[model samples]
Target: MADHRAQDKLAFLLSLVPYLVDHDRVSVAEVAAHFGVPQSQIRDAVRLIGVSGIPGETAQYQHGDLFDINWDDFELNDQIVLTNRVAIDDSPRFSAREAAALIAGLQYLSALPEHADRAAVASLMAKLSRGASAVPSSLTVEATATDGTLALIRESVSTGVQIEFCYRSAQGEAQSRRVDPLRIESFDADWYLRGWDHLRQGVRTFRLDRISEPVITTEPITFRAQDVTLPETLFEGSPEDLLVTIDVVPSAAPLLADYIPAGAVTTEIGGLFRTTIRVSHYHGLKRLLASMSGMATVVEPAEARTAVAEWAAAGAARYR
Candidate 1:
């Protein structure tokens, strides 16, 4: 628990500085809401940062050695306005082992939903590789459950039988599915089962983590690997998919990588980036927007914004 707490604090500090650098002048409440932390914690962090810095050649604190902040604005208006920064460009370069460990953990996070806190994990993985002092070692997610999931998928694929399971989609909907297991594929640390779905009467992909109570049916497979041609790409937008245009703040732009397809372009206007992403429904779009903190806005499809507004209002009403 202590280790986790320390890691969380480190992550928060790393993200907070970049966000502050981007905005320059932002309220404490806004920063707290953006990072989903308490105002007190943010205040404590700012205070700690004000006093912490590297020592000069004198082996003691010097004028330019420490960070400085607008103390009056912070105390009087509860605003974060950094006045001076020290060692801002000098990040601690990670060792080969350190880089490998962080890359492995980030690969694990890639399997989970991209939320406000973890949105930058995928992007940070690449930065680590480039910024590391030495070559990073081999890395992989050490998930024990993956072993059992792979075993069941392999059994169904080898026997050419149908696999039945409860699948939980990204939008939080759970449904039963019977699929003729065709192939087991992987992207990063995430494992996906692509097969012929009897329920939908089409080919579907299932994330192994979202699958539960999986059982192999005696029924022979209707679509074997040889019978079906799998797409070169993992995800193909369907007719049911809704294209949503959203405006994301510059600092939070990396969070949209998972949503933007290959060769897709983003439009920048007034310092905010506009991008389109495909979602199954308005509810899914709302969920995605909620995960982005306050960094994203629905720029098109009035209904999508309405859905998100209603969701937010309902959530706020609960507090009252």
Candidate 2:
């Protein structure tokens, strides 16, 4: 509570400094009434302002009656008038970390639907992206969820009601599951609903994209007072990390690096660019390779090589 009060006081003080800088002079009694603080507190705030000056403006501005502060200048009507103050346009300058966070947030926003906020997001991204020290990376991806689905999920989870949704697995297989939603959270730049699979009797994370149709069940599921934790290990559907070696064109390695996991990365050994990855499904990778216009090859991960072989054979047979 004490911390909260101090934070509130700091925030109020910070807000006042900007107004003072904008207007040059402010009445003490009016300032107090405006902020709903006591007259004594306002006096203390005025005294505190003497110690706070814009950086590099100390030689010109000094503490004096020219601090020119007067408590009785107003009509005692609690209206503070600022006059003869210097304007310091010291808005926050983003550091590299702050800039990266902003870019990531914008990318996350881009993945969502185009709302009124989307225009603001686009404008902000354009402004930041053109900054002198801006990074050469994109954080623009967006996705949309079912209307009112979020509220329904929250209510169902809190009340321990069963939720049935038509979920499309990563393999593009669609099925329905009656789940007791434990928690819904964002991860890896996407939203996930983690819950107990009453049918499977285990925890599962449902990707927002994969959930095509949601149907809430009337049956009340037994709620565990304790929170159900999401699975620590994911992408285990793949049978272990199969060491896949793919030879990619020197120019394409960088582009391919974006699609594969950081750990399973493209490496340059000697003159050749190679990608070593473990994949559960080969279809997506195959399609990506086809789109690359024969710039990439699957050297290892015998499973991927076999799939590619079959794909090639089918193409050859079609031509014949």
Which candidate wins on lDDT? 1
lDDT of 2 by residue, 1-320 (tens): 99998898788878877655444345666677677888888767666654555434465545432333444554354334433233343345466566667877876544332221455766676556433143545443333554355556655654557888888876789888888776556644467767778877887778766776677788897644266544554433434433567888797776654345556655676667876755556775566567776777888768888988898788889987
C-alpha lDDT values of all predictions: 0.79, 0.62
**Candidate 1 regions off by >4 Å?**
1-150, 168-176, 182-191, 199-201, 222-228, 250-266, 313-320
Q: What is the lDDT of candidate 1?
A: 0.79
How many pairs of residues in model 2 come into backbone collision? 15
Per-model TM against the reference: 0.45, 0.43
Query: Per-residue alpha-carbon lDDT of model 1 for 1-320, expressed as tens digits?
Result: 99999998888887887777555578999999999989999999899888867887898888778878999999999999876666663778799999999999787655432221344776687667756778799888765786666667667766667889999988798999999876667765577878889999988888888999988889988887678888876666777788888899989888667667666679899899988887778876776777787899998898888888999999999999
Best by TM-score: 1
lDDT of 2: 0.62
User: Residue 53 CA error for candidate 1 (Å)?
Assistant: 54
Error of 2 at 276 (Å): 8.9
